[model samples]
Target chain A: MHEYSVVRSLLRQVQEIARSNGGGAIETIRLAIGEFSGVECTLVELAFRDLAPEKIGRQAKLEIQNIPLEAKCENCQQNIIITNYQFCCPRCNSQQVRITAGDELTIIDIELREVGVNA
Target chain B: MNQTITVNRDLKADLKEQANRFRQRMSDQGTLVVNLVSSPGAGKTSLLQRTATKIGDEYRLAVLVGDLATDRDAERLKPYVPVQQLTTGGACHLEIPLVESGYERLNQSDLDILFIENVGNLVCPASHDLGEYLRVTLLSVTEGDDKPGKYPKMFRTSQAMVITKSDLLPYVPFDVSSAVEDARRIQPELDFLTTSSQTLAGVDEWCEFLVRQLRKIQK
Candidate 1:
């Protein structure tokens, strides 16, 4: 699947952020992938488990957070969270809506152990 | 000791920012780059072949085709217009870096249009922008009518959808209207055209739409 490539980009971004923050050995990689983003989660986890680079993040744990698809109801004037791929407003039953979230693929944070600090 | 750092980074946003820069450069030169996506054997190449023939006299058209192997698509389109192929080795989708390199290889000036036939995929390519001003996603009639609802990401992001192989509608159970309606539900503003390159069914209307869009963008 394309999750392998997505993981490569994620790993590259994680390395850059880790490098800026003292270049320590990483322990955890926190990420957020949206439901509407078209990325399969299980495949991403599989890729991370197999492909996380040894030098920078051999022991890093992958934590992927799911972001539900949320839309702004123009008629209801409120934010409605969608669970079943429906874009209609849950409260007002209006079809006119704009997506607010659940289309993001971002690395939120990381936890790292300083080189030789624990051992 | 473990240090927790809250460094939020939007990776797709970063790629899109770069894609926007590439798109802007093409816009500056009055060229429209359209990223075409579809499942394999969904008539992307045939549609382009028809498009090149119908409008080849009116515009200087060139195509860059991406596939995992072989320059076959490029060769297929060579009889019509300028063609370049980007062999991705094994990647499912063509990303910005490969697209940038392919664009350089085309090496034309003042061209009226450029078409990028993305690696034959409906899912992964939905995430990669490739610096296109417009995206046209194709769903062949044989692929079934409910694909739009099943795979909404491609339909959601695409500005237009082509129901290809309309000639097979007589033999297949694909409900053209239902497919169009499904796509419209995902993208209310999406334009739909039913086409069969074999019969030249809707090629003119498709080409006309492209010309209209090109004119609108140029003005």
Candidate 2:
């Protein structure tokens, strides 16, 4: 559903980057999809594969990096890993916490072919 | 030759930079921007209508309403204050670029507060930054109390969490304290208020809170 829209925006960014950097055909685009980013990576990849080829990144490959959830505890002042959507502090059992990472979506890298050069 | 490369590191950093730039530019003119985020039917437009009605004349208020289609919300708020309907054209969130362009289109000489009602989706809008000084997210009582846990990013990113449609509390089984507590679990200092446009319950206090935020930015 919303994954399609995410793909569209991702492709738009890729296209802009490819065009601006001397009109090179995109080879691979690396993206990081955080666990809580609310974007489904599988659906995003599917849509990107379906759509990017029609645009400037025809031969482009998509590399997705999975980001895990990380949180900090309020009571123990300790860092705990949220493995299974369990946000409470492991030691203190305090629900007061903060999500330090794992909710992100961005184009971290783009593999671009040199203009007028073939590989 | 095809070689792989990495680009941006921190998406939130980039977004924060863009937002700060916008804030600096607007600060020079003493204008405060409020970015409103919520799910569909969460009473965002209704809240805007109430705010406009209550405090439109006090400040030079203008709104940029975002939606996938139709300027109906803009039209509804137009009579009260200046409004621009930005059709995202199927995009679920309003990015900095679009908001920048929308601000240009507004072309106002002096605006005390500019409210941008983002596309009615909690998931996407929570991730995108629109360069507003204040980010207020609303969760209606009718939508249940688990929204804070279900959509943690919205509550995490927003400066204030507004629980809308409190008048329906008697009919619905939503627990207000549970929702508030859930939101606080995500962000300890997150400010929130509950209100219903129908009963005028806490509407005045909500409006006052918004005004206080604007005034803080002005000072």
Candidate 3:
């Protein structure tokens, strides 16, 4: 349900970024989606595929890179690598941990052809 | 030669910034904003109505209700306080703009507290901070005892986990203690309250809690 909202914002950013750059035909939009971003990547991809054709970046390709979660234990100060949402510290079995990675939702870069540029 | 525009923008972080601005505004106005989230039919409105009955006059209170459509909840709550409904049309969660606009419409100069009842959902609402001084997530017994474990996102983020519909405990197999235990495991500092809207058993207690929070803010 919220995937639509996510796509709408993404598209808005795409247009704004393109406009700021004096306009461009967005060739590829790259995104880094973290594991704990609370957004379903498949849903976002579906939204982009459905809505983009009628709006900005009609032929833009969406490339997503999934970021795995990493946490720092509050007790032992150890960096614990997570795989399947097991948040507890592996060494000390402490639950007090701060998530350091894999919760971001950010656009990395956009490959675009500048206006009045030859193919 | 080719060019790669390095423009990195984060939307979720932007939402957090918006929510922080709202919080600062509320703090400057000396108003306590509390956001309530729950599943559909989890007794959020009923509890609010019951609280209104018990202590509606104790403070200057206003409500902003969000749903997909309809002002039905607003109508139910109008008698007690200034209630406004925000129909999202189809958005599962109420974002910062909708909430800010709704509160701005109230225009109550001396309002003491504002309650924003989020669109009934456990998943979507948990992620969006509506600049609430307090965030409460409700769970009814009929929904089952494993809700906290199954949906940890809502429980993990909430300041308090309210167990509503306690009157149905006898008819249903919901364990109040176990539910509290499960939620506390995820959030050890989380406050727990057992309430029954029909009986109004915990209504006064919850009302008192709000009054206390309001008074704390004033001091």
Alpha-carbon runs more than 4 Å astray in model 2: A1-26, A56-59, A72-77, A83-88, A92-99, A106-119, B6-17
Q: For model 2, name the residue pairs that clash.
A: A108-B7
For every candidate, the chain B TM-score is 0.97, 0.93, 0.95
Compute each candidate's TM-score over C-alphas.
0.95, 0.85, 0.94
DockQ-derived CAPRI band for the predicted complex in model 1 = medium
- DockQ of all predictions against the true structure, Cα-based: 0.74, 0.48, 0.59
Tens-digit lDDT track for model 1 on B18-108?
7999899988889989999999999999999999999999898999899999998999999998988999999999888888888888898
Clashing pairs in 1: none
Local accuracy of candidate 1 as per-residue lDDT tens digits, A1-119? 68887888888887887788888888898899999887889999998888896535467889999999988988978988976666667788777888899998888999878756863
How does each model score on lDDT?
0.87, 0.83, 0.84
- Candidate 3 C-alpha lDDT tens digits along B1-219: 445888677766677898999988887778989999999999888888887777777778889999998888999999877888899998899998899899889988577789999999888887788988999999999999888877666877788888999999999999988988888766667898889998887877788788887877777
Worst 10 residues of 2 chain A by lDDT: A79-88
The numbered model that scores best in DockQ is: 1
Best model per lDDT: 1
Error of 2 at B164 (Å): 1.9
Candidate 3 positional error at B19, Å: 1.4
lDDT of 3 by residue, A1-119 (tens): 58778888888888788888878778788988887777889999999999987777466889998988888989999998875455678899887877898878898898888677765
